[model samples]
Target: MRYLTRGLFWIAVYLGLALFPCLALLSGNMPPGYGYWWDFSLALGYGSASMMAIMFFLTARFKRPALPFGVDVIYYFHKYIALLLFLIVAAHPAILLATEPVVREMLKPAQINRYMAAGVVSFLLLTLIVVSSLWRKQLNIPYDTWRLIHALLAIAAFILALIHIEGAGYYINTPGKRLIWPLIMVCWLLIQLYVRLIRPLRLLSTPYRVKEVIKESDEVYTLVVEPRQHEIPAYKPGQFAWLTMFYSPFSMKEHPFSFSSNPEQKGELRFTIKELGDFTKRIKEAGPGQTVYIDGPYGAFTIDRHPAERGSVFIAGGIGIAPLRSMLRALADRKDQRPHILFFADKSLEKMTFYEELKALPDQLNLQVVFLPQHPPANWPGETGYLNREILTRHLPAHLSELDYFICGPAPLMDMAEKELHAMGVPLQNLHSELFDFV
Candidate 1:
């Protein structure tokens, strides 16, 4: 059933692309030497390219790691498709200008050329977005600021592109094509409006009141938000939620934080945040009684969905310990007897996010916590270095193939763990990781 649904979705997308160009060619009012067939082909190319862009953005936003092959392949697919779309869209204008003489003629300054001007503006904006994204670091723009600019530019591009298509008077000549594209645009706009406006407004009626804010470490703070009315849906052990500190949904400043508390507790949602950027730095100062909006329960990294016999191995680094702590607390709360090991790596013991809480979990569940500190304390007893092949092999299950590993941390740490695990004979299928960034 899932495969059928996915197949049908792709079919609809392809048909939508094909219909644009065919409708352009069928329009009877085009001038001579226009090569209606060429115009139709260019329209199909542009439409398909734009569709790929939309899909990439959606997949990236939703953090879909795997597509269908039971592998983390969709991330690479999204990246490549974005590159292809940029190249194809860049060529779209050139193809139209060269193959269709009437399009070039339409570019002249006249009252009838307004549609062409709109198209040029839209294409320019799209080009700017593509270029800026490709060279964002070189441009010296931060990710948060670039994200805001990208979103606003995309909205502008979509509006201008729609106006250009409508004013072109080709596809609009057909009632069916006119209705189809406009309806698709309206649906897209409505979805965004709901995500940005309606959903947040709905959350206002059921806010999570801050109960307590505890400083777990130098940079780490744990926030406990109590449900004011009905409790929020129970999340899986390793899942995350999008949180807005301010009540306004339109604030354009929401952060995805992993739950550091156990899922068994329904009265409160706990999040451990590290002071990293503008939004996160203020988390430590937030007091009780402040209203926060929670909009998630997303992510597929959970132990509940996997087989119990597979066991569990958690790899965490620094503040990446947030989700791992959630999983550990959950296991302890449930009194699950499954064998699990937590390999936590940090620069120092002072930077560890959940020191006392983790130490207390082993009293309730079958678990082991191995701390790897770069700099050891005066009487440090635990492992005192980074988690590499030797440390992983030493602490991991004797039968590495029987365990499922969950790794989350900085990109470099995750990469290192994955490499070490694979070298230690853990199958790729037995490993799961999540990328927390929108990139």
Candidate 2:
């Protein structure tokens, strides 16, 4: 129900943006409908520009509004909607170039005006934004640097688009039409300031000091930090937070990591980070007493919210087990008797970070741990190789569809696991997945 309400709110917001140009036209000084194609092209341009502006608000990581839909889903929406807006906005000029000879004439160097030049520059920037984002990893751009560039390009493009519209003075000729755009501009600026300035300032004041760094595996480490002045925000098991360490929150370098500690344990916060990126590679260097800023407790992939579930099946690959460990530990702390099945995948027994710790969980709670290693010793007697339909069918309880399944892993493994579970009769909604690769 909460999800439904949030969905409706976003839908209404989008509908309002789509209709804003039409509303402006109705306020007088309204040019007669220039023909269906011309009006539609202009409307598409206006709507797309509005969507581009709102993208900032969506990715700002506002906690309350993002509660219903997980931040991962929000990031996915941000990526796809950006593509859609680009297509729509491009159609505006394509139609104009094809239909109006005057537009084609203005395209030539001698006939071009400053307004048309601005529109052309804006279009090029928007194109760059879409192309760079879609191929960010392929382009070999660092995530932090890419984010800063993306934001700057988007803001500049939107501002130039508004200027082009004002100079064109076609649809936005009336007093009300002029007022509408300035109001929207004000809102956009406020959201930008809040995300880039106000929120970071708040996090700066509520600083956390690193208490310890525990090596979980050769490639994985747990960075534990405690609050210096304010108490850490209470969070549920299987959720994640953005951590900014050895840098200012405003530096735009914060990275998200899942909480690996039991949430019931207060004051100190633990993040399980793998040496996957530039920032994460230096995690081991972050010693005790280093100040860190956190902006999170986000994500809905948690077992606490669904207490009614009779049991749970957890599927994890590599460091993806971080969040699931938090859930298992919390259940053990509570002495809950609910049954759980953990299917943890790793490359080898020696490299498994929490192998012994997980083995101890069965004594604390009704839990069963299944280890799947890609390469096993000849003498090994347990399951080996990748998790497949056969392995899942043999181990999963007969009432597989009745229990909730949580999967967190690399993209390829997650894709395979989800398909296999569905084939084995698990309902779609009963299976939840945590995708950390937002880009």
Candidate 3:
């Protein structure tokens, strides 16, 4: 069923691209002073090229796996095609001007037109988005701020391009062609509106009020929120949710924080967040009675989906301990006596997100927590340094190959863990990982 859905998605994507050119070619009317046959061919190629660019951006945002292939490969293909489409679309005006003298006249200041203006605006916006994204770190623009700007600019570019196409009356001459682009724009707009606005408003009614804030460390703070309404949905151990504070969806600045408390306990939902970025850094100042909106429970990084007979190993680092803690607490509440080992890595013991809560879990659950510190304290007895192959082999169960490993951490740490596991002969299927960042 999953394969079938993916296949249909790709088919629809290809069909959408094909339809753009087909519509332009079969318009049955050419722009003034251009040969009908020539105009039809040019319009067909231009439309297909534009649609290809659109598809590349859309697919990159919402990744879908292809049959017998990895999602990573599809993403690379999308990147390459996007670059190709940019070149094709960029040369379109030059080609038209060279072939049709009428287009050259339209480019003149006296004949300055809406289509030409929109085309220019679209190109500029695309250039800004692509360039800023590619060099975001080098340019020193933060991810959150860049994301907001990127979304706004993308919407503006799409609107301008759509108006250009409709107002030009060349390819979109017929009533059908005119209706198609507007309908597509309206549908796209509505989806964004629902995802960004409508759904968040619904969450406002069933609020989760902040009950308490526990300061685990200088930077790490754990927030306990109790539902004011009747019932809050019980999520799986490792699942995450989008949390919004102070009723501002336009703040649209929601972050995905893992649940640190047990899911079984409906008394209060706890989230242990580290002061990392602009949004999270402010979490320390949040007090009791503050209203928060949670739009989740998303992500598939839990033990509920995959039951193992042998045991489970959770490898986490820094703030990555949020989900792992939730899993531990949930298991303890259920009294499921399964052997679980937690390999938590951090710069220092003081920076650990949830130290006390983790220590208390062993009494109620069958678990062992191993903290790996880069710089251990004067008389620290726990493991030190990074989580390399030696550290994993020492702490891991004897039947490591039979165990299911769940790893969550920084990109570099996660990569190292996966490599070490693979070197130790763990099957790829048995190893699961979740990346926090979308990029």
* TM-score (all chains, Cα) for each model: 0.84, 0.97, 0.79
TM-score of 3: 0.79
Best by lDDT: 2
- List model 3 lDDT by residue over 203-305, tens digit each: 7777888999888888888999988874888788987777988547557667778888778887889998888777788887779999888876766578776
- Tens-place lDDT per residue, model 2, 1-439, is 7677986887687678756765666666776778888888888878777787778878988776677778877888889988888999899999998998888998899988999888899999999998899899999989999989998999999999988887874677667777777777998999989998999999999999999999988999999999999978889999999999989999988999999989988778888888987899999999889999998899989987666367999999998999999998998898888788999998997777788998788999999899998998789888998999988988888999998888998888899999989988999978888987888
Better of 1 and 2 by lDDT: 2
Relative to the true structure, how large is the alpha-carbon lDDT of every model? 0.73, 0.87, 0.74
Clashing pairs in 2: none
Model 1 over residues 130-204: C-alpha lDDT tens digits? 788778889988877887897778778776776776776453455655665576576667757766677778767
After superposing candidate 2 on the true structure, give the runs of residues whose Cα lies further than 4 Å from its correct spot.
Answer: 26-29
Candidate 1 — worst ten consecutive residues by lDDT sum? 63-72
The model with the greatest TM-score is 2
* Model 1 clashing residue pairs (backbone): none
